[model samples]
Target: LHGCSAVTYKLSKDNTTCLIVETTATASVSYTNSNRQKLVATWPLGEAAAISGQCESETKGQASLNLTFADYWVHMSFASSGGKASLAGIELFVTVQNGSRFLSPNSTGGLLLTASPKLPLSADTEHFACASELRLPFGQPGGSALVLSATKIQAFGVRNGSLSAKFATCALDARSSVPSDSTTAPSNTTAAPSDTTTAPSDTTAAPSNTTAAPSDTTAAPSDTTAAPSDSTTASTDTAAPTNGTSTAAPPTSAVPTTASPEPPLLNVTVFNSARVPCLRLQLRASLSILYRLKSGGNATVKVALPADTKASGDCGNSSQTVQLSFMQGWRSDLIFVKKASGYALQHLAADYRLSPALFPNAAEPNANRSAFGNGTYFSVASGTAYYSCRSAETLRLDNFVTMETRDLRAQAFRTDNSSAEFAGSMEQCLDDTPIDNVVPIVVGAALAGLVIIVLIAYLIGRRRHSAGSGYQSV
Candidate 1:
C-alpha cells in the first residue's frame, strides 16, 4: 500500500470509529501553447503533504472527512447503514499557481475531479478496491485525467467502546486470471449433442408419411377447377372492400399529420471592439410570461418562438438584435449590448396573443411584457469559457409580473484561444434588485431613530435643571 491516510472519530464517550485509505493517485493537465502545440504536466499525490484535516457531520447524518494539502484539497464523505460504511462522495481540487504554464494568463485555478460512486467496505476481507480512471472536461479534448489504482479501503465499526484493526487482503490483483462462467456455457451445450444418437431414427419415419400424402392429393383435379369461381364471387362483394379501405385511410393520414419537425437552434456570437470573438450563445428560443386571467387568478404561459427569426447587427458594434415574428401577429426581440470590458444582455421584449381556449372567461388576452437589466459583464481574458443557466431564473419586469428562462449556454473567446478555457468556479448572472436589501435597511433605520430620541431627551432635562438653579440663587 502507498499514499495511505487514516482518520478516527469519537462517536460517543467510549465508542470510536476509524477509516483507512491506501491508494496512488496522480493529476495531469493538458493545454495548448502559443505556437499551437499541446503539452501536459503531471503531479503525484505522494509528493504533496497533508497539512490539515477535520471530520464533520453532513445534513443526512453522515460523516465526512476534509483534508487540505499544500496545493490541493480532498473531501470524502461516508454513509453508515445496514452494518456497513460506504463512500458516498469524493471531490478533488487542484490549484494552478502559474497560469502561464498552460497558456492561460488569466486563470485562477480550477476543480480537477468531482464524482460520487457508492463503494461499500468489504465485510469479509475488510477492503474495497477501485479499477477505473476518472476524467475531467476542460472545454477541449484531453483536458485532464486522474488515475487511482491499487486502492485498498477499510472501515472499522464501533464495538464496545474500542477499535479493531483486523483486515484481509483484497483479491483484485488476481481477478484477471479467473475465468468467467459466460464463456464456458456455450462450449458445454455444444458438446452434449454428440451423446444423443436416437435423434436420426425418429426423423426417418416422419419423412416417409409426408411423401405419400402429397402423391394422393395430386389426383384431386375436381377441387382445383372450382377454386377460381369461388374467388371471383368474393372479389365481386363491394360492401366488404369499401369498409376495409375506409377504415385504413384515416390511420395513414392521422400519423403524418401529428409529426412536426423540431425547431432549429439559434446561435448568436459577439465580438469586441478589436474584432476579436468574445462571446457565443446557442439555444432554442422560447418565451415565458406571467399574466392574469378574468377570474383574478395569475398563471404563466410559455410560447415557443419561430425558427426563422431575423438577425441584424454587425460584430463589434454597440448592440445586436434578434427579432422573432410569429404568424399569429406576435413578435419578440432580444438585445445584447457591448460594454467597456466585456458584453451583457440588455433587454428582452415580447408581444403575444393567448389562445381563447386557455383563457375562455378573459375579456382581453393580448398582452406585452419586457425585462431590463444593467447587465452583468463577463470577460474572456480571465480564463472563463462557458456560462450556463440550467434552471429557471425569474426576472421581475415589475412588481406584478416576471419572466423565466432555462437551459441557456454562453461561451467566450475564439476557438484557438487557450486563455479562455474553463477553470475555477462557474460564473452566474443574477438580477441585482434593491428589494433584496430591504430587511437590512429597515433594521439600520430603526436603530438610528432610537439613538436620536435618547440624545434629545438627555439634553432637554439638563437645560431645565441649569435654568432653575440660576433663578434660585438670584
Candidate 2:
C-alpha cells in the first residue's frame, strides 16, 4: 500500500498467498568506443550508490514508480484496464554533464528512451522483460539500447492486505550490431522471377514473326507484275512520307514539356483573436520520427506533410489554438496564451497514426495516439522572418517520442498584405533565453544590497561610539 493510496480496491480473500508488489531496482549503462563496434565501458547508475525511489498511484487506474539516480532518472508507468494490468510506458532521462559516465565525452545531448511493448502484459506472469534500441540524435550507427526486466511481479495495486514484491532492472548497452543490407536480397529474388517470365513471352512472339515472313514471300511476285503502275504513283507519294516523319517528331517532344513545377513545402493562413485572418505562414522542412523496431533496434520514419496541409487558429489570444491537420491521421495543435511580453506557445499536442507497412517491426501500437508537451516561452512571435536552416531540431512530447525537423524556413506575415515581406530574422523560437538564467543575477543583486546594509550599520555604530567617548566623562 506504499503507493496505492489514491486508488480504492478490495483485497482478495486468500491471506496465505502473499502478492509481491514492489522492490528496489537497479540501473546500468554501457557506452561504445569511437569505432562503434563494441562497448568501451559499463557503469552502474549513481556510481553504485543508493538512489531515491518513490511510487505514485492515480485514480484512473494508472500508477508510476520513479527511480532517481545521480545522472539519470527512470520512470515506469503501469495501468490496470479491462481486468488486466500491464506496463504502459517507460521513460529515461539522462543528464550529460562535463564528465558524465552515462554518455560519451563529446556527446552534446543526453539519451532519452520512450517506448512501449507491442502487446499487453498480464499479472500472472513470473518474469517480464522488454528491450528497445535508442538512437542518439547525435551518434554513430549501432546506437544505444535499453532493456527492462522484472521478476516476481504480481498485481499493480494491493490485492489484499499485502503488497506485491516486484524487482525491476534496467540495462543500457551501446553499439549493438545493426542489420543494414538485409532488404536488398529480397529485391534481387523478385527481379529474377520477372526476367524469367519475360523470356517465355519473347519466345512465343518469335513464332508469329516466322509465320508472317512466308506471307511476305508469296506477295513478292505479285508486286513485280504491278511495278510499272507503282512507279507512276511513287513520284507523288514522296512528299507524303516527309510529312509523316515530321509529325512523329512533335509528339515525342510535346510529351515531356507538360510536366508541372514543384510546389512549395508549407503555406497556410492563421487567425487572430477575432477569428480573422492575421498571419500567413510558409515554410519548408524535412520531418522525421525516431521509432523503436520490434527486433530491438531503432530506425527513422520520415513524414512529408503536403504543401496544402490545413491550418486553423488564432495568434495573439489567450485561448488561441492553432491546428495543423496533415494527411494520414496526423495532426498538430499549438495552444497559445497572451502575456505581458507577447503571445507564447503554452502547450503543443500532436497526434500520429502508425502505419504497419512503414513500421512492420514497430513495438508501439498501430493506432492514433496523442502526445502533449509543454512549450518553451518566447517560441512564438508575430511578423515574418527567415528562421535559420541548420541541423535537425528535435521536439519531444510527453510520450517521450521525438519529432525532428531540419532545413527549416518558416515565416509569418499579416494576411492583409499582398506579399510576404519582413527583414527580421527568427532565431528565438528554440534558442530563446530561458527564465532560469535570471536567477543568478537576481541572487547577486540581493547579496550586494545585504552587504551595503551591513556596512552602513557598522559605520553608524563606529561614529556613535567615538562621539560618546569624547563626551564620556559626563
Candidate 3:
C-alpha cells in the first residue's frame, strides 16, 4: 500500500483490469484524475454484505479482479479495510482471457507479495445484501466476473459497472463469510447461495460442517440448488432495489453559481421644450440623454436631429455612428428651427479625436475655436415623436426633445414605440416681439427730437432781444 491504507497507481490509459490479491478484509477502491485533482469513482467494498468480499485465494489461487472505464485516466487508488488486510500484489493489463497469466497471481512477472499468506476467514455472519456503497465505475462498463464452483461455472453479469443478478450473491458475501479456519476451510464453500434465507441455514450447519472435515460435503446440492432459485429471484426482484438505488443517485437539478449575462437596453424621450411660429424664430434646443451597458465595449451610436435644427457641440452626425466607449451618456445644446407645421434640428458633427461617453460635460462657449481639437462627439440613437412650432419667449418647454435606447448593440437608440404629437400651431417661423411694441418705440423717439429743435430756436431769439436791449444800457 502506498499510503497508510491505500495503494495509488498511475495508468497510461483507460479500460484497465486491476488484479489484486486481497483477503476477506473489507476495503474501498477509488479512481481519481490527477490532472484535475478530482475524485472520479469510489467503491466502498465490504460495507454491505452484497458487493463486498474477497475470493478464497489460499487453495483456489489468487483472485482475478477486473474494472473497466470509458475515458483514460492517469491515477487510481485502492484502499483496504484496516482489519487484517493484505494485498499480495496487483497487476495492470488491458484484457483478460482464459489461461491468461492475469488469471493466476503466480503466473506472471509483476508486482506481487513475496509470501502468499492464507488469510484467516471472517467469523462475522451477516445477511448477503447489495452493498449500500456499491457504485458502477465511470463510463458504465458492463463487464462481470463469474463465481466458479469446483465442479461447474456460473455466469454473473456486471450491469452498469456494478455486480448485478447472480454475481451479487457471491460478491456480496466475500467479506462476511470469510472462513475462520483457513487451513481446513473447504474450497467448495465459495459457491454458497447469497440470499437472506440461505445465510441462516449455513450458519446452523457451520458447526457441524467444521466437525465433519469433508470440505466437498458442505458444497453439496444444498447451496447449488438454492443458488439457481436465488438467481431467479434476483432477476425478478432486482427492480425494487434498483428503484431504491435511484434515490441515492446524484441530484438532477443544481443551481448555477454564476449569473447569466444581460444584454444592453436602449431608451429615448423627446420634449417639445422650445416652440416658435413659422416666421424663422430662433428656439433654444437642448439634447440630453443617458446611455448604459452591462458590459464594457465600443459602440457606434447616432442621433437624428430635426431637419432645420442647428447643432455644434455634442450631438454628432444625423446618420453616422460615433464609435466610442460610450458607457454612460452625452449632452449638448441644439438650435431648434420653427418651420411650417413642425420644427427641425440641424445635423450635429462628430469629432474623431475624443472619446465618447454618456452625459458628457457641456462644452465651454467658443471652446471649439481653441488650438485643442473639438470636444468628444456623442450621438443619440434615433426614433422621435411629433415636432411642433409655436411662439414662445423662452425655448424651455418641458417635453420638446425626448429620446430613449433603441438598438441593443453598437447604438443605444430609442425603440420605435415611443412617439408624441405636435401640440404647437402650424404657423411658419416668426419673430416673437409684437409689431405694436416696435411702432410705439419709434414714434416716441421722433417726437422727442422735434421738441429739442424747437427749444433751441426759442433760446436764440431770446439772446438777440437781450443783446439789443443791453446795448442802450451799456
Candidate 4:
C-alpha cells in the first residue's frame, strides 16, 4: 500500500498472493515513488530518449518488488490459484496526441526469479471472484519476483477492449441534503438496471452495502464546495432508500464556489490500471471507446475505478463532476454528467485522485439509459472478444494475435469463418489504421498520377509538332 505495486509473497511458507486489478474501484491505493527510482527524470544532450524497466527480488520468505508511475496512475489486482501465488497485474497505458508520444520507450521484458515458480489459477475457482483495486502511477515500471519453494502467480493481465473513462468530480459538502421521509423518495433510491452482461436478479445487492449514503444527484456539481461546519461525511455506507429521489440541483462546475472560472479539464483516454493489461483507449472528444472481438484464455477486464463524479438536477449549473467510489458488478452508484448525452460514470473510492466521489445516488443516465449507470458495460459484439490496445497509431504487444485467424469480415455476403472477427474488431481495433501518413500518401499518389499524365501529353505533343513541321517544310 505504501511503496510497492505487486502483491506480497512469503518464500518461507509455500504461500503466494498476487494482486489483481479486478475492475473493482474501492480500496486499492498504492504509494508514489517519493524517490524516483524507476525512471531517469534528468536529461543531458542525447544520453537517452527515455528509460524504463522492471525489477523483482526474492527475499528469504518473501519477495520485494518496486514499481513507479510517472504522471497518470495505474490499477492492479491480486489472486491465487494452484500451488502458486500471483501478485496479480497492474497495467499502464498512455495515448499520445498527433505530435505527442506515449511510452516513448515502451518496453515489457522483465527480470525473472531463479526459484521454482507457483502454478496459475485455472478456471476451477468454483466461481470465486477476487475483486480489488491497486492504484499506482502511470509511468511506474511493473516488477514481479518468485521465491524458491514458493507458489507461482500470473502477472496481472492486460488486453484490448472497447472503453474509455469519463471523469466527473464533485464534493459532498455535507449529509443533510436528503430528507429521511420515505414518501417523498422514489420507490427505488438506486438506479434501475438495463439489459447488460448478466441480468442481475431483481433483488440486486443494495448499493448502500457497497459505499457511503448516496448524495443528491439533483444538486450542483460544485455542491462539494465549502466544507460544511459538520463536514463529517459518513465513512461507511448507509443503507440506501428504496428508490429515493434526490432533490439536489446540479451546477456546471465541480470546484468550490469561491474557485476561479476555469473548469476542470477532463482527460478521457484509454487507461489501463489493473493486474492485467487492457486495450488502448481512443479518446474522441468527450467520449472514449474500445472494442474486443475474441478471447482465447480468460479475458476478465474491468478498468477498476478509484472514485467518481456527480451533478444534481436541482443544482443551477448542470455541467459538474462529483467524485464517487467505483463499485464492480451490480452494486454501485450511477450518475450522468448530463441527461441529454449518454456519457456516464462509476466512482472508484480507492483512487486517490478521485476520492471526492464517495457516494452519489440521484444521478441517472443522460440519453442512453441502456448503458445504465457509470460502470463500463461489458458485452460481446461478435464473439468472445479479448482486449487489445492501440494508443493512436502504435499497438500494444499484449494485444498481438498468436492464435489462428477466424471471423474475418470481408463483406456482408462473403462467408468467411476462417478469419477471426475478434482479431479485426476488438483485438485489431486499437491499431487498425489502414492509412498511415495519409497526407503524404495522398499527395504521392496524386503526384504520381500527374507525372504519368504529363509524360503522356509531352510525348503526344512532340509527335504532333514533328508532323506539323514536316508538312510545312514539304
lDDT of 1 by residue, 2-118 (tens): 344322323221012344555566656554444646566566666333321112221233444444454455555566565455556554544434453344322222323444545
Clashing pairs in 1: 110-424
Quality of model 2 by C-alpha lDDT: 0.37
Clashes of 1: 1
Candidate 1 regions with alpha-carbon error over 4 angstroms? 1-17, 51-61, 97-108, 123-143, 155-171, 174-474
Q: Estimate TM-scores for all models.
A: 0.31, 0.33, 0.16, 0.19
* Candidate achieving the largest TM-score: 2
RMSD of each: 35.9, 33.4, 38.1, 26.1
Better of 1 and 2 by lDDT: 1
Compare the candidates by lDDT and give the number of the best one. 1
Query: In model 2, which runs have C-alpha deviations exceeding 4 angstroms?
Result: 1-264, 272-276, 377-392, 406-474
> Model 4: per-residue lDDT, tens digit, 280-387?
111110111111111211111112221133221111012112222222221111121222322222211111111123222212211111011112222223322333
For model 1 the TM-score comes to 0.31
Question: Is candidate 3 or 4 superior in TM-score?
Answer: 4
Model 3: per-residue Cα lDDT over 1-474, one tens digit each: 111232221111012212222222222111222242322221222211101111222113222222222110011112223221222222111111113222222111101001111212121121122221221221112211111111111111112322112211233234555422222334434333333112211122111000000000000000111111001000011111110112112222221122112112212222111221111112222222111112211111223222222221111111111111121222222222222332244212111111222212212111111000011222222222222223321221111112221221112111223222222223232342246777888899889998999999999998899888857553
In every candidate, how many clashes are there? 1, 8, 51, 136
**What's model 1's overall lDDT?**
0.38
Ten-residue stretch with the least lDDT total in model 3:
209-218
